[model samples]
Target: MTARFDVAVVGLGAMGSAALAFLAARGVKAIGFDAYFPAHALSSSHGDSRLIRLGYFEDPSYVPLLKRAYQNWRSLEARLRTDILTITGVLQIGAPDGKIVSGTRSSCELHGLAHEALDKAEMARRFPAFQLDDHEIGLLDPQGGYLRPEAAVMGYLKLAAEDGAVLHFGEKVTAVEPDDAGVTIVSDTGQYRVKKIVVATGSWIAELVPQLRRAAVPIRQVVAWYQPQDGFATQPQRMPCFLRDEGAEGSYFGFPAIGVDGVKIGRHAHFREPIDPNQPNPPVNEADLALLDGFIRKRVPGAAGLRVKATTCRYTMLPSEDFLLDHMPGEKNVVVASPCSGHGFKFTSVIGEILADLAIDGQTDLPIDAFSFARI
Candidate 1:
């Protein structure tokens, strides 16, 4: 007998795992597939921490979605009896006129999100981890903090399985074929027939949907953890997660000391080097660390101690850098999610719910019109 699922979510990483959990919770016969196990380092969703905040400088429209995502994360935490979100606050410091500072202020005002506008002097007095230029200022979202990427993935997948959603971990989904009858999914292990399909494959989305090959390009990203200087207060209690805009030099993001890993930091899109997701990631090289080294040394010298650990991840990018979340072109039954352009792990919870809504209900009340496929 051919096993039939009402919905099949491919790629159980950040988005797929959440979608499966939501679908199963809705009592839909859902099945999820992933090439690797949940929380695996190979996937972009495995980093120990990813930031989440309400005053989204990226766009004010995303504020509503972020609010829901925060709620969903707390619910998942309660259900799993775990701490997925930790409030250390989030700080963005840059030119008062820069995208990060100005844009964040706009979103805060538009959404009435709790925030504080801090000048360089105030920023220095509060968080002395980094040196801010006189022209630069800080926008602090007190409710913002970091989320455990691995735990969230595992938690969501566990909930999905407990709710009777079939999960195929480490099974590769090689192809997707859709027709009037439904969608046919061909995997290395077996085949499946589902009424609809959601593709959340992250970096490898193009392989399953050829039409998106040029639209979704995968690039390598690097993150490194360094031991902090003794004199500096780099712990979460003293310093919040921070993003600094160096303008032409490139943007950099970092976290306070967490666990034994020390202080972690990385350049947003190091070198913009595109890579084949199927192959092993290139080792963290001197060239990769050079940019981060100079940035930290020039700005936050307190975190410029010996590098403790370094690893590479991939980001499936779109030309616009905004997320690509919508029904496939000319294929309404197929939902494609994420290539979240580097800043997406935080939205995993809400994105999953949106994917599930689009799959089962054919539409979502979420304002994703700006992320339509027509723009790509």
Candidate 2:
């Protein structure tokens, strides 16, 4: 059968779901399709918890965008009447001059954000769960927290449906043919024609937009959960979400034990193990466990207890480690985003709005020049 919509959003993960919700909410005839169900384990949007922080270490310019993102998350929570973000604060630890520490501090200073600069002794005395080296320091961002990614995605889809957007699950878009009038998407089930299309396909982005083949790469990432040895020491009430820069080794992140999963730990780009989106995730093995175990033992001994469990996830990475959010080059009706480099979950709310603006208005007021495809 043939179908049509004012806008068609493929890949209903964090970005697509939000984009569809915004379009429908604005009275646009919007429809969304996903290969899997909302927040399915196969996508990058569901990992139990994803870090949200205003003090962006990657770039000081992202601070403004992050500010808007925080407000949008709160807006989503109010609309859903369900808690989406759990603020546990965030402690970034590294050398005084290191990227994680210095860069985070710069963002805070530039934005005049509320934060605390703690030396190694202070971090140890205040939060005994972490074992900081003599040279390490910590920047405590009160705005740091963790987001329930699954809940956020589902909430967005729910709002989209409530606002009269068509939702399809388990239906993959097999082919996308663009012409002078609009774009035609051929799915396994049927065909859809739309004036505009938002391609937020995550790892499968390169399939639809060939230009990103060399830019966006899907990599396998491994994260592990550990039962904290100390009583409530690594719990959310005491221990906050954290990122530790191990210098040359790699930057690592973790969440305090919120639920039964215990303390979760992962490196920024785990092994940089590239994988094909059409293939299954490689099995999590001893090497993955060993890397996490070592970080916990060396940095946060309190959370170095029995290994609860571990799993593999996918990350679409750009060589620059930045987000790509501009319209597809030469295609005015198409916009694409991917490779959040493991940090895009927190910005889903705002990004959704940005994507809707791009697809509908052909431009957005948001300062997304940094994320333009031209940069790549």
Q: Which stretches of model 2 miss by more than 4 angstroms? A: 1-3
Query: Model 1, poorest ten-residue lDDT window?
Result: 226-235
lDDT of 2 at 355: 94
Ten contiguous residues minimizing lDDT sum, candidate 2: 1-10
Clashing pairs in 1: none
Per-candidate Cα lDDT values, in order, are 0.87, 0.89
Per-prediction TM-score: 0.97, 0.98
Per residue, candidate 2 scores C-alpha lDDT tens digits across 1-376 of 2436889999999999999999999999999999989777668987799999998889989998999999999999999999999898999998989999999999899989988988878887788888888888888999999999999999999999999999989999988887768899999998888888999899999989899888888999999999888856897888989999888988999999888878999998899989988888999998999899998998889989899889889999998888989888888888887747778999899999999999889999998999988888
Q: For model 2, what is the alpha-carbon lDDT of residue 18?
A: 90
- Cα lDDT tens digits, model 1, 1-376, are 2537899999988989999999999999999998888767667888798988889988898898899999999999999999999999999889988988888889999988888888888987898887888888888989999999988999999999999999888899988998866888999988888899999998888898787789888899999888888435888988899888888877888889987778888888878999998899889998878877777777888878888888998877888888878888777789999759988888888998899999989899987898888887
RMSD of 2: 1.2
Model 2, global lDDT: 0.89
